[model samples]
Target: MQACGLDFGTSNTAAALPDGTVLPIAPDTAEPRLFRSVLFFPEDERTTYAGAPAITRYLEDNAGRFIQSVKSFLHSRSFRATQVHGRTWTIEELVAVLLRRVREAAGAQTGAPPEAVILGRPAVFSPEPEADALAEQRLRKAAELAGFTHIQFLIEPIAAALAYEAQLSREELVLVADFGAGTTDLTLMRLGPSRRGRPDRKADVVGSTGVRIGGDRFDAELMRHKLLPRFGAGTTYRVRGLSDKRLPVPQHVMAKLLSWHEMSFIREKSTQELLQLMLESSDKPETAEALYDLVMENLGYRLFRTIEATKVQLSREEEATLDFEEARISLHERITRAEFESFCQPLLTELEQCTQGLLERCAGAGEIDAVFLTGGSSQIPAVRKLYVDRFGEARVRTADAFTSVAEGLGRACVSLVSPDLINS
Candidate 1:
């Protein structure tokens, strides 16, 4: 029998089998890759869209009817949505759809229902313990709804550590940094031989801080601040180098720029309507829904692509440039190592402060033997540099960077079957 491990992250879902292999199961539908952790429903009815197709449709419709980043909603005190037909759906129901999809994907891929599964949980939230407990309960229920009989919720950073420990028999105190699209989690753990294979001897959760910002947020910031003014959001301007640069930026473009953030919370509806109208008049007959498609497919989508490209390039080179082929917009950004540090300085500083606070609370820094880094965003040069700078380079390591946690969870699941191996 094959055991399954599920890394249910805010942005993507990946599964690992007992044979030590990991695969990301794409969401069901036309766009067969990546789960946005979002769901949409028509306001007039209770129908809901989960995973990839729903994301694409929500982007195209932009009717304010979509529920995005549902994991984030898990942190909310209580969430109730009033649909178009005066119907309301709780956050738990929205999460049910997302988990149900994951269950279907995992079951379909392996041809076996997962015997026992490991899931990721956040370490901290604004409302303190209440938010933490709520997130935990919601996920457990979501897992149950997804058809999993047994569920184990592990701190995300610790899971990453277990993933790292399986690869090494050595005992060390390590810090694990798990950066995802939604938040950044740091854990200082002592990995050693115990009855539990690579068990966490004394783990200290330093901090899990979220800026309500990520690659998506940065892209929207850039588009709103830099691209809109000149792109004719009801007004037009000639391109810097081309005389034919006069073109309208459709409303869909603006909607895509918004992505999953909530900017209209305090703004009046009329103001939002005016903003929407200006965005519409700028380009063509682009609808809000259509603009979401553009945001996911083009604008907000493209901005993050550029950010990711720059992040990857910076890991290898000193500078990077962004080129928007369809829009004919290109910028050659010469980023020095120092300049790159400055770009992410605030976020990195916040992370460091968080780490320091956690360390202060959990004995001392010397107690931590090693620091591990995982997750897609953990690849950011600034993030790695901050950890290396704090803890010596020799003490910082990455197991499988991207797949460590999910892999560890798989191993942990196997240990459950043979209690003796957990202590081995």
Candidate 2:
């Protein structure tokens, strides 16, 4: 029976074949391997767009509703159904649409639809047990709706370890760090040529842990500290009837503006009325006007793209500049490495604590021989330093940022088909 591995990530998705070939399912005409986890629902067209084309259509014509980071909503019980293009869709149904596209692409690559699949999931979907269970249930339903008859779940970090394990010739204890868009997962496992063929390999897993923080959080931090301030994040407005009294603009509204999934809510009638009142009474009317214009023009995604680009640039350079010139909202700001690091200090500290906690949980286990990092957010210099400082530079390793998990999932599927071949 032929099988495939699917890595359905918060920011991107990919599928891989058992023969070590990864299928390119990105809807972009260029056929990039990593498909953007985004959807665009046009007002005038009945068809929906996904991946890069979705982003392009959203930018070219802002009239449509653009949805991103759909994976994050899987755990929210409050998120039931949303209306799009005069049609209502359940969360699972929306996810199924994206999964179906990936399934079709992978099927085309293999000449026949896969009979089984290994799906990569986070260590914990949510801190709450009920929510986590519900999220997994939703994921399974989505996969089934996408036409996958057989499925198995593997922790993402474990999948990364398996991908790295395939290349190991000697016995080693490895720590896999998968820093994805929605979460950072860690897994410590023992791998070697000697243990490859073992039918029961669960004993090799030493520990696994994850924190609900990743690249999206970093982007939010950058927006909150650097960009949102320019759009009146902290500005104050005078009260309508009170004398010598003023109140700060609602921080919740600013938060919604920075959130990728919540930005569209700012365009609601009630929110717009509040924004208009704030603009009329704000001491810094220009900032309020800019914020108002941003919502009215549906420029949240475009602004976020600029912020995300700056974050990526900072990962490679010591300094970066954010220059957004759209209509009446012109802003220019330069941020140095030290400043960026400071902005993300709290999150960096949380990452360190999470890693340390995982190590403590496996204290009696054997020493880790190497640290493997995967996922796009792992490219950040500060994130790299965290592992290098812990295990030394020589023991740290990295693979292709986006495809490792999918490839690892593929390897896991292969193991199920010919256990002796994968183990041997």
Candidate 3:
């Protein structure tokens, strides 16, 4: 049996075969072939759903725990486990659930389950070597639990390069930028028809670099600038210790509130108590009340969804309205493209710096023959401009933003076993 290719992304996921066939792991999402990296477990806890079904189920029911961005915590030593429906679920077990579902979905279509797979990963799981190794180890364990006997690792940006190489007839030095939800990874490599099927092409890889920042960080920035103020993140209140002094919410609390997974912790009595304190002491108690109500209603998931929708809309339109109405609170805000870009400027700079780091390993920035952009975040105007500024508009290209890595991983899987092992 041919090895399968798995792209377990932070925001989306996909599975494919060496033959370039992308498995329809998720049939109900906006994009059927690419599944959302989310899970929903009802109060019973025995039954669970993933991808679009998970989101839909969570919306229809409220007593369950819905989790998103599971991939982000893999590198963090602090995020060892989380309470799901009152049961402690480890990071490995949670990831295993997603892996098993992807494999089973592929198995149903491919006659039998595959035992081997090529797993695509980011260039930097974390800057800390120990943390990076631990993240990979956890992923390997999860794959094992998912029933894969043989697993191989491939860098995500390089995988995108392989997918882009299929379109070229001649050799070219290509720079691939994978702007994923949790990380931005880039690779400078030589690829084309002439280089295809070369078993030992390690020499073709010129340089690679990556950074931890990605699309999700930009979303958080937008929330911090445009929406958090409405929820008392920027409002001032009196604390018992600081008798006459007024202070805004602690930076740490505000940080947690911006992240979907971390926001769930707000339901704890300690955090709720803090919010109540703010509500009682703040001059603008409405904002503090909004914050308290948001957490109690388990509405962080919905808020993130609203933020994501506004983000996607901003990619196409000059401005988008963020309208969120739930129990006891209604919010309607209009954010212009300039404001969004301004909010995301820091992250966009970090992304550009990541690309520059990769290019420096080559002779110069102009040494790259072409720039191939992939991932949903690449479509952002500010992100694309940063690349264009360095490589020029004529040198930039794009592939299927979400599936390029999976497609290329499929190609890599095929090459791993083909009879032609040596390049002429």
Candidate 4:
């Protein structure tokens, strides 16, 4: 059976073939492997664009609605449906569109649609059991709608472990840490060359745990601390009734701006009216004007992309500068690695607690031979320090930060269909 593994991540997506080849899907963009998980709907046209084209169209023309991180809304009860270009779309319907694109690209490469697929999913979709169940159901529905006849799921971290295990020649205990745009997942499993062909290896998994905090949270922290303040986040304005009395601008508006999925809500007429009222009563009229222009011109995504790029740059250097000038919002600031680490301290603490909990659950299962890290956020210096501080630096192994899970999932597909092929 021809099959593939799909990693439909929060910020990006990737696919792999059963033979361990990373599928090249994005023919439309320069970055062939990393497909942006974004969609753009033009107001006057019936056509929709995904991946790089979607981002390009959104940046070039402000008339269309740009939706990103659609995977994040799988479990959102409040996000039942949204209207785009006069058509109502449920979250599943939008996700199905993305899935279909991926399937089409993979089919084009292989001359046929995959007969079956191994889909990478988070270990825990939500903290609540019912919500998690609903999230899985929605994902399954989206996969079915995308034209897959058979689908199987593998916990994301576990799949990464499988990819790492393929390099092992002897039995070893491994702990896999996968940090993505939306979540951080950890898994402890026993792996070796011998276990590669096993049909029933459930017992090999010792423990697994996850927390809903990752790259997006860091980007939001950057926005809240550095960017938003320049755009009237904490500035004050006088009450219309009393000239002497002043109240701080509503922080909730800034909160929405920091959020990736909720920024679109600020474009509504009611919010704009409220912003205009706040602008009139503001002590700093210029800041208010910039804030008003920001939402009015629909520049939230562009700002976010700038913030995200800064974060990525900080991961590689000791210092990075954020300079955003668009829609009459001009701001430039220099950020040091120390400051970025300080901003993300609380989240790092949560990640430590989550990993410790998983360790406790896997207690008495001999020493962990190696700790494997994957995902884009894993490249962050502070994030890497978390695992290195716990398990010595020498014990940690890293590979293909973004595509490891998808590659592992593809390996899992081979094991499912032709166990002998994997062994060979």
Top lDDT prediction, candidate number: 4
lDDT scores in order: 0.59, 0.85, 0.84, 0.86
For every model shown, the clashing-pair count is 21, 2, 0, 0
Tell me each candidate's RMSD, in Å, in order. 7.5, 2.3, 2.7, 2.0
For each candidate, give its TM-score against the true structure: 0.71, 0.95, 0.95, 0.96
Which residue runs does candidate 3 get wrong by more than 4 Å? 240-246, 364-366, 417-424
- What tens-digit string does per-residue lDDT give for candidate 2 at 1-424? 5578889999899888765567877644565688787888888887788778888888888798888888888899999779987689998888888888888777776676665778899997898989988888999988898888787888999888888888999999999999999999999999888876455567889999988988999998898888887889778987767866888888789889767568888788988887888788888888988898888888888888888899999998999999898966887889887788899999999999999999999998877899999999999899999999989999999999888999888877766555433312
Off by over 4 Å in 1: 1-3, 18-20, 27-67, 82-88, 198-259, 263-269, 276-317, 323-340, 364-367, 416-424
Task: Residues 177-229, candidate 4: write the lDDT tens digits.
Answer: 99999889999999999899576568999999998988999999998878787
Task: Put the candidates in TM-score order, highest first.
Answer: 4, 2, 3, 1
Q: What lDDT does candidate 4 reach at residue 314?
A: 97
Rank the candidate models, highest lDDT first.
4, 2, 3, 1
Tens digits of per-residue lDDT for model 1, 1-424: 3456677777766677655467555734443434457666654445677777666776565554555566766777756443434655666666777777766776677775564676767555343777768778877887887777667766677767777766666667667778776677777766655524533323333333333334444334444543444333455323334656554444553553454344323134643554455444434333332333333333443444565566567667776664544332344444455565665566677778877777776665466777788877677677788888888898778755656766766666665434432212
lDDT head-to-head 2 vs 4, winner:
4
lDDT of 3 by residue, 113-169 (tens): 777888998889999999999899999999999898888888999888988997898
Q: Per-residue error at 269 for model 3, in Å?
A: 1.7
Q: Of models 1 and 2, which has the larger lDDT? A: 2
Q: Spell out the clash pairs found in candidate 2.
A: 196-423, 197-423
Q: Alpha carbon lDDT of residue 276, candidate 4?
A: 81
